[model samples]
Target: MTGRFITLEGGDGAGKTTQAALLTDWLEASGRTVVRTREPGGTDLGQRIREMVLHERGHVAPRAEALLYAADRAHHVETVVRPALERGEVVLQDRYIDSSVAYQGVARGLGADRIRSVSEWAADGLAPDLTVLLDLDVTVGRARVAAARGDTFDRLESEAAAFHETVRGAFLDAAAAEPARFLVVDASAPAEDVQRAVRTAVGALVGIPAPDPSAS
Candidate 1:
């Protein structure tokens, strides 16, 4: 039996990690095997790449950054995601091809088509069965990120406001283009509300009731 692939995407501080954890907990409670993972740092090698792309203090050329992300994705899918799916498990992932398209392709001035093409080739064209887009205003997102990070922004997070706005638009455009694969949630809502929406959407995929919020 094939498994489900689900991804969470949004600007920084969109509460993806929290929602992913809640979903994983509820799914496991429901008797399903779940593989919770993320791009950039999902594997050992990916951790190193994540450091370079996100934490390193130097400017990486936009194309180089995109290629690094694609490299991590290629290895992540082949080694981690594919094996989990082949085992008939739910792969709950944080970020995927769309992040590359938005951050590197559109926001960085590279063509989205070009970056998406490269990313698709890297992952052998594996697409998520469901992609939850946590839509949030860039300004609000940045403020949340700053509060959580104590003003310590990562390389991408340190980008100008206009860059983040571009990234937000790109994500929305992508969701609009592929509504069948996307569930857009207003992330500005309370955290529990957003998670409830995510669980409702994901439960429909796995044939489970959205677990009670108090239980989660």
Candidate 2:
């Protein structure tokens, strides 16, 4: 009995990390084994690759950046995500192929299909059973990120507002294209409200009841 795969995605400051933590705790309290991890840093190799892609001293070409991400995805899936799922543990991932498609493909003008193909090949066609998309205005998302990490802009975070706007559109388009696999939530809401929505959506996948406020 293989376990389910759940992914959380959104632009920066969409509260994915917070929601992921909450969801993991809920699943664990429900007696399900959960493996919570994130992309570009899930493994030792991935951590090195992450630094190169997001914090290297010099510029990396758009295609090079995409391939680097693909490399990390390949290793991460084989080493961390797949083994956990094969052991029948729920795999809760933060960011995945969707991030590459939006950031590299649509935002960088590198072609979404092309980026998708590379990522699919890297992960050997693995995909999440459900992707929770936290949607919010680009400006609000950026402001949240800035406040959280003052004077520290990552490679992707430092991009112009217009670039993030394009990335946000790409995320919405992806969600629209695959309604069955995606649960889009308005991230402008308060954190607790957003976590409630996330719990409701993920509970269905794991055959658990809706979150109990008292338990939380």
Q: What TM-score do all the candidates reach, one by one? A: 0.96, 0.97
- lDDT tens per residue, model 2, 61-108: 999999999999999999999999899999999999999999999999
Model 2 Cα RMSD, 1 decimal: 1.3
RMSD of each: 1.5, 1.3
Query: What is candidate 1's lDDT per residue for 1-216, written digit by digit as tens?
Result: 398999999999888998899889889988999999999999999999999999999879988999999999999999999999999999999999999999999999899999999999999989999999999999998999988878899999999999999999999999999999999999999878888888888999988987676742
Clashing residue pairs in all predictions, respectively, total 0, 0
User: Candidate 2: global Cα-lDDT?
Assistant: 0.93
**What C-alpha lDDT do the candidate models reach, one value each?**
0.93, 0.93
Candidate 1 has what TM-score? Answer: 0.96
lDDT of candidate model 1 versus the reference: 0.93
